[model samples]
Target: MDQPTRPSKTIACLSALIKIGSSQAYALFDSGSNTDSMTPEYANAIRGPRIKLTEQVTLQLGCIGS
Candidate 1:
């Protein structure tokens, strides 16, 4: 079996309450992250214009290949 990979560095995060449209939601802010993400349910709950990506992209969370 392949061993689980470990994170190379510690990531800093902060908890915050933010407004999306007229609704407020609790969120985590990651200082080390270069990208933004949210749950599919949350995305659907908020009112906004969403842009459909022409190409799907994959991201490595925490560390590379994680």
Candidate 2:
């Protein structure tokens, strides 16, 4: 079996999330990633308006967990 790859470097930083238009606060974290992304459920719950998709494109996702 292949061994999982490890991150080259690890750094700790303070995280902060701000609302789109208001001064309210919100935060979503994923230990696996330091990128700024949110789950669909969380987005939908906090989204303001919806933009209809004009195209149908297939998406392929990688393994969700190691």
Q: Which 10 consecutive positions of candidate 1 have the poorest summed lDDT? A: 5-14
TM-score of 1: 0.61
Candidate 1, which segments miss by more than 4 Å at Cα? Answer: 1-13, 63-66
Show the lowest summed lDDT stretch of 10 residues, model 2: 21-30
- Residue 37 Cα positional deviation in candidate 1, in Å, after optimal superposition: 1.3
Error of 1 at 5 (Å): 23
Candidate 1: lDDT over CA atoms?
A: 0.78
Put down candidate 1 lDDT per residue, 1-66, tens digits, no spaces.
887776857544578899888889898876777888877778787756688999997976665666
After the best TM-score superposition of candidate 2, give how far the Cα of residue 4 lies from its true spot, in angstroms.
9.0
RMSD of each: 6.6, 6.2
lDDT of 2 by residue, 1-66 (tens): 987876757544556677765434566455665445445765576664555779864554468583
Task: Give the true-structure RMSD of model 1.
Answer: 6.6
lDDT of each: 0.78, 0.59
